[model samples]
Target: MSDKMKKGQGPADEEQNAQWVASRSLMNVGSLDESGYLNSFYRQGYNLSKCLSESFANAKDAGADKIVFEDTESYNRIIDNGRGMSRDDFKSMFSFQKPNHSDRKSCGISGIGGKIAQCILSNKKTSTTYTFNGDEYLVANAPWDRMFEYGVFSDMITIDNMNQYQIDMFNARTNGNTGTIIEFPRNDDVIDVIKQNFSRNNKDDKQSKMECVYNPCDMINVVFGGFRLDISYKRRDGEVEQMQMYDYFGEESEKYYDGKTTRTIEHYYDARKDISRYILKADDVQDESDMEIPRVGRGYSKDPRKVSAPYEGYIKKGEYVAVVGQRHYTDMDEEPPETIIQCYDDRKKCFYDEQFEEGISDHRAPLYRNGQMIGKFHCSDVKYTNSRANSKSYHEIKSVQLKLSYSTHCTQDNLLDKCMGIQQNKNQFQSEDMPVNLTRLLGYIKKDKATMIYKYFESIRTQPISPSQPSEVEQPVSPSQPVELRQSVEDSMTQRSVNGYVTGPLTPIQVTIALGINIGDLTLETLTRLGKDRHIIAMFNAVNK
Candidate 1:
């Protein structure tokens, strides 16, 4: 026997000695209430996909390149090519209610992901976890039923030398390298729940089942690069079907033509205020179209007159521009629904926009923190609904989707901080402060620019064109027509003089008509002095009319 094995040997054998030491250490060091800790997770809410996502996140944190999920006749296994756990790590994993690992940037900040998953999977049954390190291995056997019966966590858990079957399973999955393998008795209910939860169709209806079949490959695609998850299952015909991470989800293709238009606003950290502020503004861009129309002056007048000035057709660009597209959920024959104006805040990862349908409240955006969606906000002025599939009252906007996103630093804004303070279940934020902040922020958005752009395109689509006259139609004019045409031109000029305002710089004829004098009587100095005087210009325009 090797020196290490010989040294570990006791009365019965090395294997028996290892088991005793493991059990003793667990009892001596593990000081936590397993049942209470697990109950807390249940109270918080247990999502099957979230549990699995936590496991995958852990694997990524460990720098694992490959992960596998296999269903055997007796057990279901999840194996990963991650750095195997040390003795301390193995113990710490089960030490419930612990904080997150300080070094890892993991989403499982509570450090209960693996424990919750394992306990739920075992469900009072026996489960095994093996961790391999070089030539040595550690095994943890969890007999949950026995532990619950004894009311002591250490009584049900045993740390021992790995058995041959476990060694074989580990070798086959990790190619005999250092890694971790978890196994539990095959439970169809758990497997079905996982399949249903991770399915893409559950994006909108997370709580209930839909007609779509579960595709593990697509699920992997949705959460790609974080970790690799593969599933191996047997078909009814006795053939094994294996699925690996694919490059695209089913909805990705649909987004190609009907994706949301996005604009990003970056803010640098400010040291003075100890917060970052992103100022949202839209820039004006000249329209490229060659078509020209008359430019109308602002406000109303009883006698409106067109000047020599033409419309420049300048349009607002940058963040001020809003996306105008057909509704994603309309049929071909049906008229396209109204444009939806969506605003997404990237920092908070929340959206604020008008609701599609009428409900009790006008809330339409879902709030999120640390990637997990919490709840909705219903401030009177700026209400938002939870975006989760389980929300009982979801609001939809039929027309004008306006999406906007705020930076993470903006959450620290006084108004937002107060609103977020009263959040429940991280799900809903209720405070008058929310509406106050939202109203202030939205004031910067130029809705008139979006409306002008929408109208410009709408006119092109609806305007009717008159047919051209045929070449065979001959035209002739009498001599008297030329004299009448000149008389009409003079009459039109006289009418314009009656209605036009003499403001700013004016031509000789304009000044002559405005002052009711001949052109020869007007001097450059006189015209400049009269143009600058609002009272004189107004009186001259009124007298001419």
Candidate 2:
């Protein structure tokens, strides 16, 4: 791959591929088909693919990994090593805002998952999958009828001899030594667009150009050396900032891209914690860090992994943190810390675009990879997203005006619950230092630390995405629209209900229930009014249990 990229093209040749020249404007401005459908599904797929790849992109370290965006019009994605779930995880991946997922850690947030991807792509879910280790597996959204001779499935699918490089890669990746692959076929025009839009531009400063036009939000994609935690200024606004650790971190860091000079900073004793982070406005940065805080942006988490429920020992943690980016990255196989805290999306207010609630809060944290989504931190993420740069979304959702807020502090953000909304008390975590055991709670007190921790996390509903990102999450507005699209999807980016979580692919019904709703009644005012207007318990409730 590296040889292909390097030997393939240089500046002048790269310039020939218009895809590199066109900025972020291309994201939102896609070609529409005669059917009025958005024909630029390639960009949509690329956008989603980027997020998926990012989860494993950094190679799980602060240095040594290399993420090189290539010029090839057609590229492939590989998903390997997830032994048991190779197939289930593939099926539920879709384009819906905060769609519920099988792996909920990196992606499971309220409003930042597959659903958001769907919204970007005109509410569509166009994908194909194959599972073969000799035994037949399910398949979806492919043009198998035209190409394959035969295939088989139990319930919903089958296609045979469905040869595609994409599927081959997926298969190879899945089987570890072997796996299945699924690729969406691109339209002829899209092929040109992909080529023209995403060229092999090894321009002068890959740093300067490793940006998505307008969505300057992409800027943070380059901030991995040491992320900027700008929440301090606003955090001091109320009494809130005092106990919060979202503004905490390590010192001595640098930000670099594949082909650009590096940016460095010394945050050896920074107050912010490692997990949750924030940005600094120019003035704020100058005042505090003695440096000009570049224009930063927030990325909502859009991972589509579902959270597993609270089993005794299955505690899991995920972080979509861009340990690597356009410049400096980790080696291909470094393992990040296995803490259960997820590294993407908001915990309190999952996937809520600040615009709906009105701007300027620490909600969206600008995430990076030479400032690219690497597919992890979008204010939203899922099946697909726009590539048109100059679209009205910027003004519609101004940068300075909106933000995504989260917390590593745990206890801070979910103010209503006072538990682990942001969960700052590291003491609560099961560690050797505490010298305390959860056995007393179940057996000691006397449960086990696992149960104790589960209850603890559940009580506060630790949000997955950090509060360091600018955020403004409030209750849903009672808009006159027909019962707003029920939150059918789980945000691979939203925070989970502290203790329990959904582990595998969820049915639409399961997702709806997890979101606490019944899709059948979305349009019914009677159901809406009933929830809005609750009746007294009347003391008659004591009978059943």
Candidate 1, superposed: residue stretches over 4 Å from native: 1-41, 47-49, 133-136, 154-156, 197-545
Cα lDDT for residue 9, model 1? 47
RMSD of 1: 21.5
TM-score against native, each model: 0.46, 0.27
Q: Could you report the Cα RMSD, in angstroms, for every candidate shown?
A: 21.5, 28.9
lDDT of each: 0.43, 0.25
How many residue pairs clash (N, CA or C atoms closer than 3 angstroms) in each of the candidate models, in the order given?
33, 164
Candidate 1 structure quality by residue, lDDT tens digits, 468-511: 22122222222234455534434433423222121333345654
lDDT of 2: 0.25
- Give the RMSD in angstroms, all C-alphas superposed, for model 2: 28.9
- Candidate 2 lDDT, tens digit per residue, 1-545? 35534664423556543553464244645542322222332333334323322222222211213222211234222222222123444444332232332232221322223222322222233335444543444344433232222321112233343457645544543433333333343333323222222221222344424431323221222222233211111111222111111111121223211111112221111123222211211123223222211212342222211222122332222111212111112222321211122211112221222111212122232322222221112232211122112112211122111111122211122221121121111111112221111111111110111233334323332322222332233233333323222221222213222124324334434333332345563322322333321110110111101
